[model samples]
Structures are given as structure tokens and as C-alpha cells.
Target: MPNPSSAVSRRTLVTAIGATAAAIATAPAAHAAAPSTTAAPSTPAPAAPGTQAARTVTVPATRARSAAGRAAAGVRTDFPIQYVGVSWDGPRRGGAIRLHHEETGPGSWQPIATGCAGGPDVAGTAAKAAPVSAALVPAGGAVGYDLRLPDGATNLRSTALDTTTGPARTTTLSPTTPVTFCGVEYLSRAAWGADESKRFKNGVENSPAKYYPLQTLTVHHTDTPNADPDPAATVRAIYEYHAITNDWGDIGYHFLIDEAGRIYEGRWSGDDGIPGHDANGNAVTAFHTAGFNSGNLGVALLGTLVNQEPTAKARRSLALVLALAARTHGLDPQAHVTFVNPVNGVTKPVDLISGHRDWLATDCPGGIMYGTLPALRAEVAAL
Candidate 1:
């Protein structure tokens, strides 16, 4: 009624002031609720200790089967089954077969009749025997066994049945197939003496003639498994290695034995009946042992013993080799061989079957193979 314009202006001013107050209040509240642009306080969960994750694994079937089979057979499952040799009694009619056992630790030889089958010779029987296993025979070791036939027999024929392959191995024996070792026909001195000169002379050419009075017969394992397992080839390779790699004239050892227990002539040819010499003023000594190379006759067996054992034929050949060496050296075959440790110069009375490690710092024959030395020597004594 007094002035409408003035009244409206006053009202608008009151409304504007109210709106400004409200905006100020809301801005403070929003600022308090929002996080600051600066770094926020860390709240990390505790970390786990440094550790590897768990894993699952599977074993091979052969190993598992062997373990189960051994457990059921009452034999220790941990040790590998090594076929040492087969034993058989011979007769004109037939023979009984048995397989000789060699356990992993130091133990006496045990016989297992489960794996063997009747065969012409122990090898044929062993080849056909169940389990279908094989072993490396160190030089001068036996690789087979002979069982006497029952009375009233003229000839024997037998075989081995391999359990793994289910195959039969058979051999027929005759008078013409004479027992041989190292590829050289094994004949009595009387029978083969006439060819000694030719054979002995041939041995000399295998290496330069180096002579030393044979004082010791040292045993060794080749450490390498022969791929071909041939005694002749094995000897040849050894000679070449010595001549080429070692810069020696020929194979250091005088003799070598294959898995079959067959012996092969090395540096000193069995034909020549002479010993070898080295470039270092040592006799053409066998290089079986590292430090004891000068006065020792090294006989290397062509196989490793990590998971395998020496064959029975190899064992027999080893015994025969030792016998020959002992006879040649004039050492008592029944007495222990003297081994002088090259490191400490400590002397030990090793059996006539001393090992390469017995005289050197290195493990020449390996643990399992060397472990059987005592038994080997005893067997040699009996032989």
C-alpha cells in the first residue's frame, strides 16, 4: 500500500543472504567428507614368509613295479637287481639251473633259483633267466657258475628264460667250442704253448715295448659302459685312448675284461707275454690307478657299477686273470695284495684282488664294485 517496488527489493535481498549462508555450510561439510589429494595412510595385510610352493611328483612304472616285485619276493626293494651269473648242474640228460645273487651292500653271495632256467652253459641259462638283467664283470672276475651234473650224463643243453621279455635263450654244448677268454682261445699251456711266441709278439706291437718287473696287479673299472660290449673293441679303444688322449704308446693296462667275462689283451699283448712302459720313466704300467701306475699291473673291467653288478663270466675271468698275475708275479695267491696309498703313503694289505682306489686318491673301481673285493679275493683263493 505505501510503495510496492521498495518492498519487493527488500524481500529479494533477504533471500540472497539466506542462500549464501547455506552454501558456505554445505562446502565445509563436503570438504570434511572427501579424502585429501596427498598420500593416504597405508594399511597392508601381513605378508606370508618366503617359501616354495608344494609340488606333486610321479615315479616311473619300472621303478614302482620293481619295488613292488621285490617287496613281494621278500628281497629289499631299494637295491637294483643285478644278474651276476647263472649256475647249472650239467649231465648228459639235463641240468638244474640257479641264479647267483649279489646284494647291494657288503654281503655274502646268495643263490636265487627263481630267475634261472636250464641251459648249455651258465651264460645261456642266465641269458634266458627271468628278470632279464645283466652285469659288468671286472677284469679277473667270474661271470658264470658251473653246476656239476647228476651221475650218468654225457652232454648237457639248457637255456635261460627271461621273465621280463618272456623269451628263452638256449645253447648246445659240444667238444669243439672250447672255453675262451679275451677273444684269445683259452688252452692249457701245453695245448697252446706253441703259439705263445706269435701271440706275445703281437701284444708288443699293440704298444711300444716297455718292461718292468711285475710287482702288483691293480684292479679297475672302466667307468664307462661299453656300448658294444665287445672285448676286442673295448681293448682297442682303451689302447687308442692311452696312445691318443694320454699320449702314451698304447692302452695302459695289460688286459681288459668285457661284460661277458671275456678278456682282451691290452698294452701288453697276451701273445707277447711282455709288460708295457710309460713316458714318465714308469714301466709301461697299466693306467688303472692314478698314483700307483709305476709298479702295478692294471686290469680294467669294461663297465660301471653304479646300478649294475659284474657278470659271473666276468667274475670267473677276473679270478683267472688274478691267478695268472699272481703266478707271474710270484705273489702268494692266497695272501692279500699290498696297496700303498699314493696320498698319505699309507700301506694297506688288500686282498690279492686290490682295487684302483686302494692305491690312489680317486675312486677307481667305485664303491659298489670295490665293495665286492673281499668276496672276489675269497673266490680267487678258492679258485
Candidate 2:
């Protein structure tokens, strides 16, 4: 496992001082009492010179249904789905809900994901229904799940989705080809079924476009269901959540990646479907990291990965995007970078490519994936 302490120390430098140069300059006292050995590693092995084959893959759409019962709720489908997720509208009684799936036998199902209901948000934020999801390594032919419910619960309606189509690339990823040259689907808001009126109730003109020089690239996990059947719907749901629930006026990330490695353009850039560029000719900024939103590009992988690993296609696509970003921004993928957020003017010294956890006090990008950063950077460098 990757060490969180190292990440904590690195983040402490920026978080302790706030977003001002004056705060940073006057915060020597914050570091004076710290141990001298609390720093990230100085050097890492360089990636070997090599070329990977180019490939193409597609994730099939998912279908879903729901029902109420004490026994398993089996929803059959036409094909096998590699992932599954459940959104329940059960009785609002908070309790531990156990979720599981099986290949061929009854009661032989394996536990995949867990979620709790009725718990108060530490900040006492507004209450909302909790959704849970799980990834299936060996895609199942049918979709059927059972929920171990607590006593006196009723009206258990669930939105269960199964994706029969697993990710399979039609072309291999060649080290020489940048992802920009690859077939990236730059879907407009309508393509993903986003209601512009819902997102901008005050009127489109009220929420003007915001831009900043794109600097560091930060990766994050949606922290939602990775087993979504329809990636587009998942994207739309997130848009609503971010715009309405979080009141951010837009999806926070600049780009979204599905489990099959498909990339979607996020956060309206006002350049039609083309990516917006800054006056200096760099890519425009996105609202991904809070204090680091300015001058940064956020690319979020669409799944929670606290204990599970991302799919191979997802990782490859991530490398391709990161490489393209490095090439576009004149960055060395393996080099250390210093970024000053245009929003708060706070600075962070980080890897040319970094995880969201590196910038904030949160479990983002997850542990399994975060540990792969060094290798990911090396792969980008090679590309």
C-alpha cells in the first residue's frame, strides 16, 4: 500500500498556509516543529524506453429494473455485464445494507460493495439517498442481486444496472500517438442528456465562463458507482449532482473517463466542442481542485477505487490523455512541477501528473490507483 503519511506531509505545506504568499512566507513556524525526514522520495526509476501497441475498446450500454422483496431481486438481461450498481428508494430507515452478486448458484454470491443510510453528514449537510456500486472482474451473463435488509424496512425499490458489454479495444495504444489524435468523443451537453435550463436556472448569461492557464493535471475518482451500465447517464447524474446539490453551476472536472476508457469533455468551455485555450495558448482551467482550480486541468476516472483497481483500458486511456496534456502544455511528465493556482494564488510543488489526494485532505483517486502514479508518470514520459 502507498503511504498516506507522505502525502499528508506534502499537502500540509500548502494547506497550513492558506492561499496567500504572505501566509506561506509567514508560516515557517508551522514547519519548524516538524520532523526533517517527512518528505516525498527524491528519485524514482525512469521508465524503460519502449512502445505499446495502439488499441480501441468499447463498453456496452447497461439496462436496469427494480422491485421490492425480502429475497434476491433478480433482473435478467440479454448479455453479461461487467459491472453493477444499485440506487435504492427503500424505506428511509437508516441501516447497513449488504449487497452481493453470483455467477451460477443461489446464496453463493460474493460481496462487492457496501453502503450505509440514515447517517448524518459530519457537516450536517442536507440528506440524500445513498447509492452503491461494484465492479465485476468476470462479467456476469445476467443481473441479479440481493440486499440484506434490516428489520421493519419496506418499499425497497432499486435502480439496478448491468453492462453486458465489457471494454475491448479495437486498436492498440502506440507510444508515438497522442490521445488528441485518437478518436475522443467530445460530447456536447445535449449529447449526454444534460438540461441546460436546469443547470443555469438564472439564465446562461448569468454564469459566465471562467478561464485560467492550464498547469498541473490532477486525476480523481468520481467516488460513485464504477459499474454503471450507461456511462452517459452517469455523467448526466453527476452534472445534476454538482450543479444542483453542490451548487457549482457545472460539473467540476474538465474531463470524464469511463471504465472502458472513453473520455468525455466536461465543464462548458464556450468553444463549441473544441477545447478552449488561454490567451497564452494554453488550455483553460477547470473547477476540479478547490484552492488549485485555477491553472489546473482535472481528469476524473468514473468510479470509486478505494480497494479495487481501475480497469486496464482506463489506465491506458489515462496515460494517453496525460501524455497528450504534457505535450500540449510543454511539460516533462517525469519532472517535478510548481503550480500557482490563479484563483487563490497558493502554490503546490507536485508531480507533473498527480492524484487528487496529493492536493487535498481526502481519499481521492483511491489507494490502489494512487500507488501507481510513479509508473503512470514514467509511462507518460516514455510516450
Candidate 3:
């Protein structure tokens, strides 16, 4: 069956119905990037050649039992690591995975969190390939992990990630100035060292970029450790996890905001200068929301917000981005709207600025951050 999202023209869709989009491509692939103006999007382009993987290490779980008579595994990594996740070969099931960290082998252990699982919405089943459910979590730049796996699990695989290599890669402890466009300032893909070649495998893109009219703007948290050493590198690791590890061929969120209030571009919208919008001010469909990805825009906070709150800088940036999106898309940040999915016609009642958990049965965008929606909405509305 032909995809209704890709079959329609951007201009025609906007005129017929004012719907925004989250990306869901149907074709093999094309290149992407948007223009500086709120209106400019050339067709997608073919990406550059592939670069060999480096930094990401796949560690096999060594099954063990602790004194508590619970199933667990111990991974003593020798390299500098930042993120961790576990995967199984079979279908995803209900269970919990707890991770602790140590800076050295057999040193000391501290608890991190259980099932910090995050990424593109698993509920949306329209992608060309299935994404391996890696209950991904931030490793706090630790050298080892204490793992507690779910009972009766099979084909277990654990992977550790480290994007900061050495002196060669910039370990930017400070935020850089973001490029301004669409009434906001943000880091472009090139600014953050995005390897666009990853969009393709051999020669064909996994899923081409898709565009739709503006709908709603959503918020989320990366579930990564706060006070990030190199937020840019964290963004790259997430791109790798989502594009390659999850097999989505792109990052999930439309924008990622660091603790310092620097906003990095997420998902390849186009090369036309606009971040998430097409030449006509239409939005690019992203992987943030599952069945309702077509017109919802997703912006994520960089660190874990479960127990803590976002820095004032990050909150300011979030409000700025949301306000601009709401103004541009003709949305009331404080009002409720029933969103209709453009492709599948799924209907969802949502706030103009909602938490990630609003769309699916997941604790995303964190609990504390989700609770401040009313204030966030008022701030955006005021802006």
C-alpha cells in the first residue's frame, strides 16, 4: 500500500489541512537539510559514503549470581565509557534491568537506574525494519557496570558506548553558539560533527525523509547523566544508537537541548536552512511519536530529569524553541487539541506542549519535568 504521507504534496497538504509532521519515510532515501528562512526545503539528497564504526563496543554479558540470589552480570570495561544498554534476540517483553557503575575494575559500585530505556517510539510500527529494543541508559562515563537482568531472558547482549575518544575529538565542556533560524538559535548538524553518510547503507537509505504540515510540539529528556562532559559527543552517540543500533537510520527527536541551553539539531529535516521545517514551513516527520509521528515535533532535554530539574539555561532554551514552534505552527501553547495522524488516521488528545509519556506507556521526558508542563506552557504562551 502507498503511504499517504509521502504520496501527498507538501504545499497541497498545508492548504488542505494544517497538519505538522514527525518523519516517516517510504522511499529508499534522499539527502536532507533545510533553509534559513521559515520557508525553504529542496528535495532530499543522497548522503555521503559510509564511515567505519569506532568507539561503540559490544560487550557480551557474563551470567552470574550475587549473594542475594538474584540473576546478574558484571562487565569490567577497560575503555572510557559513557552509555550502556542490553538487548535480547526475541520480542520485547515486560521486565526491568538495573545498572550500576564503577570507574575501575572491581572497585566500588553505585546504583544508576533500572530500565532507563529511551529512543524513538516503539509503538509506531511503520518503519521499514524493526529496531532492536536496547533498554539504553547513561553510564555516567564509568569504566564498568553491575547488571541485573530480567528473569527468563534469552540471547542477552550488552553494549557500552564512548564517544569521547581523546585529544583528537573536541571534549567540549562548554556550549558553542547555535545557528539561528526559524526564530530560534540551534546547532546545525554539521556544527555538531554529524556523519551524514550513516543515513545510507551501501547506497540505499533505510527510510527517506518525509514532510508534513505543522501540528504539535512535544518535549522529552535524553535520560543521560546530567552535567555532561561532552554533550555534543552524547548527541553523536544517540545518533549512532538510533540510526544504526535501532536501525531507524536517523536520530529520533527533532531537537536536543543541553544543560547549558545549547540546542543541537536532531533528525535530518533537509539542507535547505530550516531545521525541522520544509521550504514551505511544513515540518519533517520524525521518530519521536510512534503512531502519531506524522505532525508532532519533538524537542528533548539532554540529561536525566527523573529526580532532578532542568537547569535554568536549559529551561529557557526549551521555552524559546516551543514558543517559536507554537507561533510558527499557529498553535496555542496552553490549549488542548485532538491530533489526527496524517498517515494512519490515529487520533490523540494532547496539549500543544506535552511530555513524551503523553503519547505512549513510557516514563519519558522524566517525571519532574513532566509535572511542570503548566508552567512551561504558560512560558511558551507568554513568549
Candidate 4:
């Protein structure tokens, strides 16, 4: 077992995985290291360093992108950053928020291909005094960032995450590669640096884990940067944003696949070794879709797929997981099925394997990835 608290690097999680379908409840604890501590900054710093613990920094909320799409106003951090997400004190809006990042050194700026729009403005979560951010944009190994917020997008702020800190994950990381539990390259929460303690506050769970009978398997793209350098840290940053900032108590998806095709376990499904289901195989309700959470299994690819195609490794893990879920849940991936909110009893027709945009008014999972949903469905069905 790798330490639960030690950091996980993209290198450790990268492995060649062509998996077979198996129920998560019966899966193995494929990898882990004992918990290790790193003093992460809770606030922003003024200059760049060789490395730093993973953390988020607030940046100027509004700026205009140049006609050439150059990053307008920006901020510098003391650590190498991996991803950036935009948030505002207002409702989510339309308009491209182009971004640029300085890789390690000043003047080496590059544009992030996927200009972000954040996530769907969900019900109930809209009234929080907290800023509502859309999707994330890639900023690989960047030490500085710049952005363009949509016009009239008030109180704009950027959530820039420096996930490329920490030492290179060594052999201490269990398996040091993907582990096959039946058929997928699964990374347990322990495989990443998830602070299980974050799931609780004042010794009580923020929201008790809830499960319902499985219905549909929905695929999503996190709208983060691609070619990630430290996916495990990225996962941790997302966990922080979702569990702490978003008050969701956990990351929203059931699973997360890195570009290397490793399927990171998401949403703290249970103690029975299952990633997203109860013993009876009921799906755990997560925060991905607003009105249709219950019974829908949400799996997010860990990057902005709309701008670039997911690597072949990511695509394989995605198909394997979807195939595994469909097999475990008795779903027909290629057919149109009725999706009923197990909590609200509201029903809608959906493909057996659908995209985030299919159920919400957002460009999630990206255009490039979304277009492959049909092919993904067939692949899942074939599996």
C-alpha cells in the first residue's frame, strides 16, 4: 500500500491498461503509499519557485483577450501551475474566456486552446456568496497566468491551481502503475493524495454518502488543461474545490480518467471496495448533474477534451470503465433509455452512454469528446 497522504504524480498513475469488466465492490486495493505531509500554501505567493505544495490562488476576475487571443490581465505564482478555472460572483455566462500561461519562465507564454466557460449554474448552489466558475482550462507547467472574462461578468476571479509541485512519485507508490481489478487501470482515492478528512467537518460528514439504483452512465470532460503533468495533484485540487469550496462534500464524478488512461476512483463511493456503487450495485449519487443526480454514474475525463482529442490511453480507460459500468448495471450502452431522477421521479430519455451536455445546458466533455459519444456507446456495448 502506498501512503494515503503522500503525493501521487502523473508518472506513477500512468500505465498501459486494457481492462476487463468487473464490479468495483470486488476490486482490489491495487496501489497506495502511506500518508506524507507537505506544507501547502493556503494563500498566494509573489514569485516562482522550483516547486510547492498544491494549492489555489485567486486572480483578477476580469480582463479582455487581445484580438489575437493573447492573455490580457494575469497573475504570477511561486510554484508551477497545472490548471486554471474562472469563477465570478454572478451566474454562469456564455462567451469565450481565452487564457495564456507562462511556462516556468516569464516571456514563454502560450495560449490554452480551450478557453473555459466553467460549469452549469446548478440549482440551490447558485445563491452561495462563493463565486460560480465554469469549466477549467489547461495551463501545463505554468508559473504565471492571464485571462479574458466575458463582458459584464462581474466579480470575476480565477482559480489557478499549482498541481505540478511535490517530488516525483517514487516506487513507494504502490503498483507504480495501473492496477487491474477485473479489467481497468484503477487508482483508488489512496492512489491520489485525497485527504479523506476533507469529506468531513467538525467530525461529521459534510453530506452523508447516498446511493440509489443505477440508471445511466454519463461521461464528462472536466474542462481542465490537457497533457497534465501532475494528474493526482489536479485530482486533489478538484477535490478541494468540490468538497470544500463547492460544499459538495466530495468530487462530483464517480470516476476520473487521466490522459494516461488511468481511472482514478472518484466520489468516495464506499468501504466495500466498490468505486461508485453499493453492494447491490446501486449508483452513488454525485454532484455532476444538478436535477438528475440520483442513479446517474458520472465519469469525467480529466482535461478539456473539446480542444484536443483525449489520448488513446484515456479513451481506452473510458471505454473500459463505461463497459464495466454497463455490464455491472445491466445497461445497453447503444440504446436510448429512460433516465428517472431516483430522488425526484423526473424522467428523461437518454442514450445508454451520454455526455454532460446531453442532460445540461453546458458544453461539457468538450466538442471533440462529445462527438465521440456515439462511438463510445458502441464500444461500451461491444465490451
Candidate 5:
């Protein structure tokens, strides 16, 4: 459906009965820098000419019993890596284990940031065990991972994920064609291994995905680990947790931006969805806000921003995404706009690019990240 926001003459965008939206809303106008400017190795490859679709390979698990009886396992993947997550049977405790990775052979092992196995609190999935945070490894490189445990850490496991080289050359928009928005390239669901997203338990689903007219863009942070070795893996784990554990059926954000400035498609969108608009035209509706989700698009950074700021790459990518949203939706990035939650009949005034806190009384997109929204808006406006 054409987003009511985009279809200005159509009836005001409404969700449920008694919902009211403004009429004659005027269209308005609308990052960080990153180091090395290289795309994530697992940055979903765009479909190319004469190339087969990107394929997925699940590296076999390697497990060992330490001399002290602590469990340790490591696996290496040959293809470009996208997402990574771990499974362990245990309770939350003080002792910590480190998951390290080498971008290439014979290099120093760097620790990949991790989180609980159950997913992060920001997403509202309850934790079941202490699992390592997954990584979205940047740029296609020969990557290897090693899980190191102290004497007592046990019940540990890790998996290596490699997504498609890129999106399929053919989409509903074109056959053997390339697609891009703003100044950034987008990875398709297949590029990020959405097929690997954890399935809903018992095949049960929550309410069907909702749709709304594109209006506003909501910025968020996954609140997972920031120093991810393979952020794609962390994203996959989030997809799984949101689907299986939280029963949300899919990851909550419409797009995910890693520290490396890689943009991964979030919350699968169908063929009919709008390419540049928000949730309503985008096919996939998400749960990033409580009362106001339908018309808003969510672009989430990969890590916590409550204290620390996003990587330069992340900031740059966010600006591009918001620029696309603003231009496509006729929104002015620097202007404050009023939005009506079609679902709840509630209204809120927020910047075209808003922090999660603006919608709810929660510390979302983090205080540090939220504070940067003004600067981010300026970047979008410039774009």
C-alpha cells in the first residue's frame, strides 16, 4: 500500500478505529565519520551480473574438554562472515570468557564483544544463559575464531556464519539489476542470512506484521556488544532471539548499522514494500516503540550508546539512512514534526529523526547516542 504520508491526498493515515492523523501536512527537508572506510567483510554483497546468489555455509563445530574440564571450542569459516552467536547451558555469573578472532592467518587474536545468550535487555528478550555477543565481521577476509575459557567456564559453544556474497541480482524491482538508496548500498535479507534467523517456537506467531505510512525515522542501538568481531553474527543472534525467545517473529529494527558503517537489512520486507519509505511502505513492521510503530522506520546501531559514542563509520551510515528517509518521505530533518500513533490514537511531537526516548520514557538509543541526534540531523540536512 502507498504510505498515507506519501499519499498526501489520501485519507489521513489511520490504523484502528477512532485513530486520527493530521491533514495537509507539509513536506519538509531532511553520522559520524569512520576509520579505514572499508565495508564489513560480511557487508551483504549486492547482486552482481553473472554471479550466483550469495550462499551460506555453517562451519562445523569444534569442541574440546580443557585439562581443567572447562569446555572450549573454536571454528574457522572460509567465506566472508556476516553474523555469529554462541549457545551455552549455564546461569549468569561473575567469571568471564573471551571470544577472540583473527582477520587473517598468523595474526594477533582480538577479543570480540559479547552479550548474554538470551539477547540484550534493550530488545526485551529475557536472558536464558550467558552467551557471547555475536560479531558482524567487516570486509570479506579469511577470518578465524577461538573461544578461550578460564578453568571453570563450561557448557560453551560457538558458531561461524557466512552470508551470501551479496543480494540476489534479481528482485521484484528488477532482474539482474542493482539497487541503492541515498549514497549507501543496502544488503538484502539473504545477504545477512535471514534464512538462518531463528524460527518462531511451535510455529506460532504474534499478530501479523503491521503497516503504516512513512512519516518518521527512529534511531536506536541494539545495546549488544560494540567491539564485535563479526557484527553480522550478533545481528543473526538478535534475529533468532527476537523470533524464538521474544516471539516477535523477526528482528525489531528495519535496518542495522554496525560500527564499521555497514548497513544490513533488518525485519524482512516483502516485494511490495517501499524501497525508501518507512514501515508502512517497507512491508515489515517492527516493535521499536510501544504505541507508535506503524509509520516509523527504525535504524539501530549495533552496540550500546548510553556512555560511548558510535564508531565513525556508524555515524556516517546513519546520516545516509536518515537522508534517504527524509528525502523519500518529504520530511525536513531539522524540523520538529507531530506524529499520530495509528494504533493507539496518541500523538507526539518529535524531530524527523528522533531517539527512542522521544517516543517512550526509556533510555534508548542511549543518552550519548540520543544527544548526538542533533548533530546527526545536521549531517542529514547537509546530505
Candidate 6:
């Protein structure tokens, strides 16, 4: 005779086991069975081959459900979904990497690997074929890596990651001008500031000042040559002349460059670097320019070039100075500004580079050198 209680218990056990087996077979590999706390019948049942059975017979159903939710949300795997690699395929070396994304959340990407050659270790080892790993990037973001050259300098290279599929962008950098050739320390505004107050000539001084967000750079040429012939003496003489003859607090121009292409500082204002003084009994502005004195930077060369042609060294120095001035002022080199000839009333689309004659009544920068202004600007643009 079959016991009635035993028969009921057997039926319940069979139903539960069938349901669990079906779930295990159909669910994804990421999902695994969770333990349950409810008591089972006296005779425990066996599951299919390769299936893991619940070890502890006391897990809450709520906990199992929470774990399943996390697994479906991709929380079970710690490995990154994307990877990055760097390589130098000849002409396609340094550039920035742009990452595009389909979603709009806070996302970022990082380098998991790098392909670089010999140099000092940075972020890690700096040898050829050495792999470097970076911290994980947030979703929808990018990172940049500067590859080291054999000479132990860095070049631009970038990588980006996107959780969603999107196109990548790259920006190549042009060769940089050597800091020494540019006449001032590269990227050091403070260094340039401290060097301005020294005298270049008996009466002239080079006083450095901050730029005041002005858009125009007024160019000029010093008409006299001191017997000293030394660049520092030339700058000193100009400062003294301006202070004594012109009765100004400092030099008129913001910068002065000697024929050797060395930059000297002139004038001082707060960090804006443009020359300005008090008004009232200070009623008159500094004599840097006549009409545009309020919003222009005056830069004077050390010697007269009206009759002589500017040398290659002088031209390069001027271009660098102009480029630096334009960048500091946030002026666009490519954007053309209108220059209406004060005498003829004819207007020309002048490049951001301008002459002293444009603002004041002087043959500043002279006829011979001024003719080459267009070419000079083109050279700087290439840089």
C-alpha cells in the first residue's frame, strides 16, 4: 500500500525539479541557479549533467532574484568591452583620436595598450614593443598618448573609446618651431615678462607689459642707431628716450627684437601685457600710436630698416613675435580685418598683421621691409 503523504510529497518534488531544469536549459550562460530556503521532500532529486546544484539550502528567494537582475545588467563581467592599440605606420604617425558615441551619458575611453619605441619610461616603460596600460575610461570618452621619438621627445597620438559604435577622428600637428629660434622661451610668458625692463641703448629701455586682449599689433622701426651696436644697449636707450623725451612712465612698445632675432621685453602693465597709463593730468595716452593708442600693441625693432632689407633672421623673429602676440590676444590669424588707407580711403583685407602706419602718422617698419609683410605673414601661418 502507497502512503498518501508520501505520494503528495513525491508529486510536489517532481514539479519543482521540472521547472528548475527548464529554466537552467533555456537561460543564458551568464545566469546561474540561485539557492532557495524552502524545505524539500525527504528524498532529494538530481539535476542534469554539467549543472551546479545549490550547496546551501537556506538562500532567500529575494536574494536570488536580486542577483539575476545584476547579471542581466552586465554586472557579472569585469573585462572591458573595448581595447586600444598604437602603431606608427610611416606617414600616419602623430595625431589626436576622436571618439564618437551613440549614447549621451557621461562616458570616457582609456588606453589598454601602446606600441612605442625607445625613450625614457613615462607612465610606465618606454621601450619598443613595450605595452602600457592606463586606467579604465568612462563610457563615451577618449584619451591621448604622446609617442616618444628616438631623441627622447614626445609626439602627439590619441585614442578614444565609445560604448556605442561611432566613427573616430584624428588631428595631425604641424612641426613646432624651436624655442631658441623664436627668440623667447617657448610657452613661458613669465620668463618673457622679467626680461623686458633692461635697457637696450643709452636712452632707450625695453619695458615689458601684459597684453590687454587687443586685436591689433602695431609694428614700428627705430630710426636711430646708437654707437654701442649692442642689442641690450639699443633696448636700454629706447626706454630712456621714451621716459625722458616722451615723458612717459615706460617704453612705448610692448616688445623689441634685435637684429639677431632675440626678443626683449618692454613696458609693464598688469599681466595683460599691453601698454597703458593713467588719464587726466595723465590726460594723454602713451605715445605708442595716435589714433589707435587705446587698443593696440606697439612693437619696435631695434634699428632703422627703412633703406635696408630685413634679414632672414629678423623676418623669422618678427613672424614668431607676431604669432605669439596674435595667439595671446585671441586674434585669428586667418581672419581678415579691413585696413582703410587713411590717406587714399581705399580698403584692403589686411591679415591680422598690421603696420605702425596703419594707426599713426609714421613710416614705421619703412617702405622696403613693409612690402614683404604679406610674405612674412604667410611664413608664420605655415608654422
Say which candidate scores most in TM-score: 3
List candidate 1 stretches off by more than 4 Å. Answer: 1-208, 226-231, 269-284, 337-351
For candidate 5, the 10 contiguous residues with the lowest summed lDDT are 16-25
**Regions of candidate 3 where Cα sits further than 4 Å from its true position:** 1-78, 88-103, 107-133, 140-148, 154-157, 166-177
Local error of candidate 4 at 108, Å?
Answer: 12
lDDT of each: 0.39, 0.51, 0.62, 0.60, 0.53, 0.37
Summing lDDT over every window of 10 consecutive residues in candidate 3, give the lowest-scoring window.
Answer: 23-32
Query: Could you tell which candidate, 4 or 6, scores higher by lDDT?
Result: 4
lDDT string, candidate 6, 1-383, tens digits: 11111111223323432333333333211111111111221232464687633221211111000111112112111222221222222322222222333344223332222111111111222112111111111221222222222222132222222222222211111122112211242211122212222223354643222222244566677654422234443343344434332234455666666565555545555432221221110111234653344334566666666778655555666666666545433456555675432222333344567776554334667777778777767754554
Per-residue lDDT over 229-323 for candidate 1, one digit per residue giving the tens place of the 0 to 100 score: 33333343343334432334444566666666555555543332222323222234444444444445677777766456677667667766665
Residue 270, model 5: Cα distance from true site in angstroms = 0.2
Higher-scoring candidate on TM-score, 1 or 6: 1
User: By summed lDDT, which 10 consecutive residues of candidate 1 come out lowest?
Assistant: 29-38
- Selected candidate, larger TM-score, 3 vs 4: 3
Q: Candidate 2, 334: how far from true, in Å?
A: 1.5
- The candidate, 2 or 4, that scores higher on TM-score is 4
Q: State in Å the error of residue 199, model 4.
A: 1.7
User: Which segments of model 6 are wrong by more than 4 Å?
Assistant: 1-183, 186-211, 226-228, 271-286, 338-351
RMSD of each: 38.8, 15.8, 10.9, 11.7, 10.2, 36.2
| Tens digits of per-residue lDDT for model 2, 1-383 | 11111111213323321322232232211111111111222233354566344322232233434344443345444444333433334433343322343444334545433321211111223222232211212234444445444355453433344423433212222222222312333444433444455447656632346655456788888776667665665675555445443345677677777777666667776643244443334444445565566556778888888889888777766776666565555567887778765444466788868888777655678888888889999976776
